[model samples]
Target chain A: DAGITQSPRHKVTETGTPVTLRCHQTENHRYMYWYRQDPGHGLRLIHYSYGVKDTDKGEVSDGYSVSRSKTEDFLLTLESATSSQTSVYFCAISDFGSGGPYEQYFGPGTRLTVT
Target chain B: SQQGEEDPQALSIQEGENATMNCSYKTSINNLQWYRQNSGRGLVHLILIRSNEREKHSGRLRVTLDTSKKSSSLLITASRAADTASYFCATSGEQFYFGTGTSLTVIP
Candidate 1:
């Protein structure tokens, strides 16, 4: 366990409603990431934060946005949820390591359903 | 996409049998990692192989990396019913990209 926790482990919402998922880490790692896993697509990064108030978009950032106001928390928000956005979302954290491999620790994941 | 591609989207084997999964990537990577996810759960890091290394073993799991071929393979010896899960390969460069994954079912 990486001291990582995600809120609302399972959620179901209407297509046009806004939904937010929260990831909190107690390890104080420098890097935190949000990813979505779906059939045939595997896991795709949605966004990541390198530091507090520092974040970047990922490969599939079209329908999602993220915020990291505090070092321990990273939040993913869907301004208007779409049925296509239904998937299992995971949060991971990793520390900055020098000269070698860095391993990421994952949370339990959030299963979202947009009806 | 820097995502690696995993061979044989699904696999089914009897307990005590060995299971092998392969992953192929396009770009150069610093390291390749394997993760296992049970149904509806988060992924657990299985093992990691650096680009310079050819093979590594952790208990019953063995990982082989072939940088020249830009590919890797994971072998689970004497697989058990508990080994049933979806396995994914991820490559790290500027960012980490994960493959489609192989769903393995070890029937006991």
Candidate 2:
């Protein structure tokens, strides 16, 4: 799992409830990303953090928010969960240096089901 | 929007044979990366090819990129049952955009 860990490996929640998923990394990489994987959509980036307190939106950032208060922790929050947001979430870390291409290492993933 | 698209959504091959998968992207990219996922678990980075580079090799895996055509191909030689997984290509520029993945089944 590349020293990356996601809390609440599996969760079942009702629509309209708030949900928060945690991604912690011991690698202390410079870049961290949150992604959701669905049957036909593959993986879609939700948000990414370049450093502590520096975050940016991704292609699929709607209905979701992210915060990186610490270097080793990145949090993804669903203000109000919806059925459409039900998917497998994954956290990935990358070292983005000049040595080589930025290869991402991913966590085991968290499965979220909204009913 | 997704930047990459892969063909032959599903592939079935016998062990000891070779497997090949293709990926096409819409726009220019700094680099392209291939990843493999077993079942529905997390993705594992396989190989990465830069735009300036033509091809790269890692163990039994070979990857080639064509910048002019905005495409790439991944070839795995002497496939084994353990190689059965979903393969995806991701393009990186300002950010990473992943394709819909190709499912490879290596029958032992």
Question: TM-score for every candidate vs. truth?
Answer: 0.97, 0.97
Task: Report the lDDT tens digits of candidate 2 across residue range B22-61.
Answer: 9999988889999999996899999999888999999999
Off by over 4 Å in 1: none
lDDT of 1 by residue, B35-85 (tens): 999998899999988888999999999999999999999999999999999
> Candidate 1, which CAPRI tier?
medium
Question: lDDT per residue, candidate 2, A1-115, as tens digits?
Answer: 6899999999999999999999999998989999999998889999999999999999899999999999999999999999999999999998775634498999999999999
Q: lDDT of all the models against the reference?
A: 0.93, 0.93
- Candidate 1 chain B minimal-lDDT segment of 10 residues: B88-97
Colliding pairs, model 2 = none
The superposed Cα distance between candidate 1 and the true structure at residue B79, in angstroms, equals: 0.9
Which whole-number lDDT from 0 to 100 does residue A45 have in model 2?
94
